[model samples]
Target: MASSRIRTFPQRISGAMAASLGLLALLVTVRCNEQVPVIMWTSEGISLPRQAPPTAGHIVGHQQLASYLEKALDVGPRNVVLFLQDKMSIEDFTLYGGAFGNKQDGVFPNLEGALRSSSSPLVLPAVSWPASNAVIGQLQDQLDTSPLYMDPDTLSQLRLNASSPALLVFRLPYGTGSDLLSAKETLSGNDEVIGQVISIMRSQAVPYTAVYTGLQPSRKEAAALSVEGGLGGGRSLLQSRGGYKDRWRNRERQQWAKEKREVYAPVEFKEDDRTCMLLWAKGLTVGILRNNRWEEHDLTPATFGEGVSPRLHGSDCDKSKARLVLNYENVLGHRSFKLVFVMSQRHYKVSARRWFTLDAVELEYDGTKATFNGSRSIYAPAEYSYRCHSVTSFRWPLLVPRSAKDPANQWRVSFDDFQIQGFNLSGNEFSYASDCAGFFSPGIWMGLLTSLLMVLVLTYGLHMIMQLLTMDRFDDPKGPGISVPQTE
Candidate 1:
């Protein structure tokens, strides 16, 4: 019986080793088959039915406008197209008088024919005179009616003809409220015209600077219309009043002088000028902490525009210096969504301190209470000495929705005063470290432990083989001893 047991030990050891190897393989297969959740980030606040945020550009006098165009053309090959409303140009109507059937009507009836026949140079007194390099091509004037009347095919052809990074200048007619009917009529027409043009530009992803020089109810009205038509915030330059013009020009000169004095000023505040994007769910309730009091601010589609903050000002803090906080909650029966906050400061600088926090905990910044789970600081060096804008972006993931069909849940939060300390690093160096224990799931740890056990098992198997190889067979007195016939 002892001899038989000794012979079977090898077989038993082999079976146990095979079983361990098979179990490890099964664990690996099970772990790999499990699904991993995916997360997405966006800069545009919660998804909405409104148009995209506007681009950045300035609205100055004709001379300053011409300078911008000239600079744009001098750099490289660019498509610069001009659209002039026949109402804004007396010369255009005079040149194409016959097309309207009666010269006194002041209407150029045949827009296509007039555009094809006109040979005069496209000129705007507010921009520049004479010619600056023949950069402006494909001038479409004698457009006496709303752009809605123009041929869609012609617009399509124009878009195709325009090169990448094109500059489209729309000098449309904006009516005043003195004549309500006329104003309504003009606005409706203008909306349709500008809307179509914007659609084309957006489809082609072209960068355009629209200059509205005609009559309008007010500067605010003009800006609202431009933003509604999808012009970028800084890119659409509405023509302001003469007083406003002088003030803007003075500011520009002062800024230029400051730039000349401190060549490194931009480097110091480089990160402040950048565009920051934050996203949150729609219909989120927000609050502002002011003077140790919390003020509620309702978030709605009507409140958001080209700027980062809503239309309503919550606190006495300066718009540039104000800090923002986002809160998210995890609960049952709610739709999961995100909010996107985009800040684009042109010729100005802005700094952002971002953080994340759980719904169960409360956060404090400078003695003000806010809710957040994590935080991060962002900084970027200036890329251009004269004028450069930094673009920094971060995202926060809300809790997974319990049900996809639940009505959107609402939450309120507030922003309070906070101090920021600056840290400068040479060249563009960045580091990220996380201490959250739950960041990794259980499967990961299990896989690691299984690998360690496999390594130990392999080492033990090797040691057993070595022992078998070097052991003395005579030392086992219980085994089937060599039949020496027991000479004693």
Candidate 2:
């Protein structure tokens, strides 16, 4: 008795549209106070180098980043707490003598007592220092908790101390180098872990010292001279550098720099400058041309092998920096891409002629690449990676200056990032500033807006599509000989 018009209704949303809106709302809500362009995939990672990296190189990155933050708060080692998430600071030749002790936690006989000493680096009085036994024990537990993304145990340990100027280096699990069966499995939960960290940070009221990501190539992490390590560390070293002449050196360092010299002028080709990030599409095999146009660069016999293609280079100062990263998102056909960076030093050793150099490069995008670059404290490029240095990638941090000579007063380090945003697999490297005003540059915000619009349009289009499919309108009127297969 009822003739239905198929319950005609204008579909306003689809599952995809609803999901997109939810994510957008979540983004807007999560970033209410911040105007900085939101990067969603930033995940948690650590860099526990097998041995100690040099102090001079590792301390400068943070120092520079800290200088930028000091505008709001009086900052330094004394007031701030340092979290050596990985072996980066511990293993490199450069040393950072903070509350966390040395590579193995034995550097300081007593962290609390050390801070209390007159010669201690503490700017704040020992009474204000959070370097107590309980705090140290808590930190040890946190550092050793899961050895990967911050698990509940690690989170509990982190929350145990209310240290004011705390510095954290969340190590990527693969630094251990034992059970990384594949790439994705090794760099686990980077984006998820980052989200968790942001949640914890937001819940707190008192703003703590700056948060950072430690970046490096675990493969280049040299072996610890001590007997403390197990099978994993020794194996990783052999797998990467076993056949090389200098087992202790970065085989690819010099070559990385050589490429940079080709692109820019010698002056522009200073150390620690990023050239570009090489990206490839995901869900792709070695030979297939991605998206019918983008070329493939999966040199590895097996797709997505652990080794990185582009080499790295920098200065002897170990103060110069650069980074090359990978990326994948279905929106971009899940193509792989790179983000190269050139970071300037914090406590730059000023000379009549200022020069900078780099140590190693890290590959991000796949979760496993987090051990080195995810920390945000490291950078490198595929320049000149040839010859005698014992190691390639290591933990490098920058220290900031207290006072300035010019309002442009701040250091002028160039930044080159290679990005791929649209349907095109193409990208290019570029230079930018990290100063206060440039921190939130117009270009980044514009990109974010464009991405947001695209997401919305795609969502709405799908909503209409789903609506049409579910209704009687999309039904095959003939309903016969409809055995045609789909085509790409």
Candidate 3:
């Protein structure tokens, strides 16, 4: 019996050890599931939004949205939407009015038509989103004591997940309406913020197509670690410069053209006036006026949104790929003017900052005055203007794509600031501008720094240890040898 027991013990121990090893190997493999990189676009240079934006009904506000996104959209700690929490006050309408206060209270704006098919708003049907208690609990602190205008981030985040994030949208530089450019121009420093958002998205290889609106605060201090380098001037209708909108479509591969409501672009010149600014075609640039001042006025009637330009035929013009010549002869002594053409949409999509190179830029105005010569993509090189001084950027224009086969009106195109550079002259993608991603992204730079730091530290530590040991060993005659028998 004793001999049998010893034999069984060895067999049992061997089986258990094999199982343990198998489990350990599995856990390691599972943990090694590498995360696919993601792109992030924070409105106004702020990646984490602190305040709740008035979006898709604050039925649930920011607090709820953040929690919902953290669980559903983010893959791990490294991939979640990070909200910058803040406190603010809204009107406590419940105190001022009772149950019958607002006529719209009982009638949900979006669900009014389906009321008969469902229960009353007072006791809504069981929802896929969190219970009202869960959402309100998360927001209780950030929001004021107002009952009607309660914060609802948690609820929103839940709802966002239930629906298709691919279709979720953003407003232009201003409020969500037609006047995208004027709304954007009202607030300055837009260029700087845009540059930052672009770089981060590009480097992480974020898959969603994006949109942005509102003024960029130019007063923001330079940040050693800021994605876009720093803020602009800190000007705007909002109270502070940062923590505005920390939003992103939380889906894998958010295709643009399929989801974009508005258009955005980064430019170097505000108004490039060189030619008569007539018939224009596609290629991604607007025409320059003769006066050297951009004349990208509202081609769209006041009734239309600023982002929407009048049809090409509406302006009584045909599709033509015109050029702007920066000749000193055209540089009128008295008339300091330029023209910006709002080309049709056969080619230019008025999309977000991706990547492109300024192959050749020459100043041609019927004379040998200047030449736009360069091999690099940065349009604003130090010697940029010196070589083409006379071409002082009527503040560049953009070419709205033109479809040769479409009716003239169908091909009509117009853009505002934030639009295809109705004013901004630079032809760089916002994603890579100023440490932001224009033609480039911020993730690329950050990844590079991270790798370099790791290499340097590891290499230096080994060198120091070798030096310490060698210093003492120099006194030994046989060079610190330890003997051991050879094994066949």
Candidate 4:
């Protein structure tokens, strides 16, 4: 019995050891297969979009609609019928009509019938145009007899001074089955009538809105339509220099002012102007414009830390122009990024300091780009009313991994085409760091701890095995021992 128990002890110990090793292997496998979540940061805060679709039956007021029309169709007429037709199916068209309050007034049986009996104020005149000048003269005589047909100039002035007109709503028949090409052909055939109607509207200075219910258009088709309708030429009414001024004032009122401000002087770079070098490195192309000329340079690992100083003349000198410096500091497990922008100018007899703010910053990594709108300002203190310089520093968290083994984590910094709002930089340089930390990340520390625990467990198991193998069996002679009983 003692011999059997002694042999079974080693087997039980081996089984337990194998079970522990298996559990550790499973844990390691699970950890290795886990996916890491990515986190992004901006000045506003962490951004996460609400996951709900917009509610149905939302009513957009008249003022909101006017704003939309001004932005989408330009500041011309408040009322205009924009027919967006393409190869999309009718089913796709039904999905887009909620914005204008899709209330049905009447439904025409077919497209031809719809055009003939269309309630649209713009189309009605075109439908009723006289075919001959004699007919037009007859209508004019009838109009002259009525007191309503007073002076034409007065009528035009009244139309111009009138408030915005009501929205004209129309819906296509549910089963038109008409393709985009066919619909376009039908409208093109009526071009003469359409042109006459447009001429009359422009002459009268009246704004009218019309909505054409048809198939939805793709992005390319929409862009083409916008160009054809002259909707792409005008500047947006909502955006202006005054908007920025208001933003600055609001920031001041909210007590969000920064410690310093960078006051940048005006600098213009024309396409044909050649003054600075154009640097191309790692799929990034930067055009350095200086002194009315452009110079070209290539950025690489070898030239990363080196600074390029361009020669300036007259007003283009460093004292009058903004200077931007880009630096990369390699630290343990990651890389730190910093952007330093300096603005300097000569001030005379001014005791007060000037303040300027950076409105936005845009960064592009490889092919992906992100824009951040955070205000960082600097104050330009006068040096005895002679010279003043203000510096603004922007620091970004570590981005690149420190481990060379992680080639996937390596990223090349590019700022040649980087956009810094509210200032046009005159010069820039890339600086690199010489020293970096090794195995400094939290993940590395956790891995080391796990490995140390595993080693201790393995050592304990081996020590137990050694102790069992060298144990004195004869010490327990009364219970279980190796004895030659027959010989005795």
RMSD of each: 32.3, 28.2, 25.5, 34.5
Candidate topping lDDT = 1
**Cα-lDDT of candidate 2:** 0.28
Candidate 3 lDDT by residue in tens digits, 82-129: 211111001111111112234333212211222122221111111112
Q: Using Cα atoms with residue i matched to residue i, what is each candidate's TM-score against the true structure? A: 0.20, 0.19, 0.24, 0.18
Off by over 4 Å in 1: 1-62, 75-77, 81-153, 157-177, 204-211, 215-488
**CA lDDT, every prediction?**
0.31, 0.28, 0.26, 0.29
| lDDT value, candidate 1, whole model | 0.31
CA lDDT of 466 in candidate 3? 77
Query: Lowest summed lDDT over 10 consecutive residues: which window, candidate 1?
Result: 35-44
For residue 70, what is the lDDT in candidate 3? 43
In the range 204-292, model 4's lDDT, one tens digit per residue, is 65554333322222223333443344323221331243488546545643442232222112122222253221122222222223466
Badly placed stretches (over 4 Å) of model 4 are 1-98, 102-254, 257-440, 450-453, 456-460, 463-467, 470-488
In candidate 3, residue 112 scores what lDDT? 21
Worst 10 residues of 2 by lDDT: 34-43
Score residue 195 of candidate 3 by CA lDDT.
Answer: 36
Which scores greater on TM-score, model 1 or model 3?
3
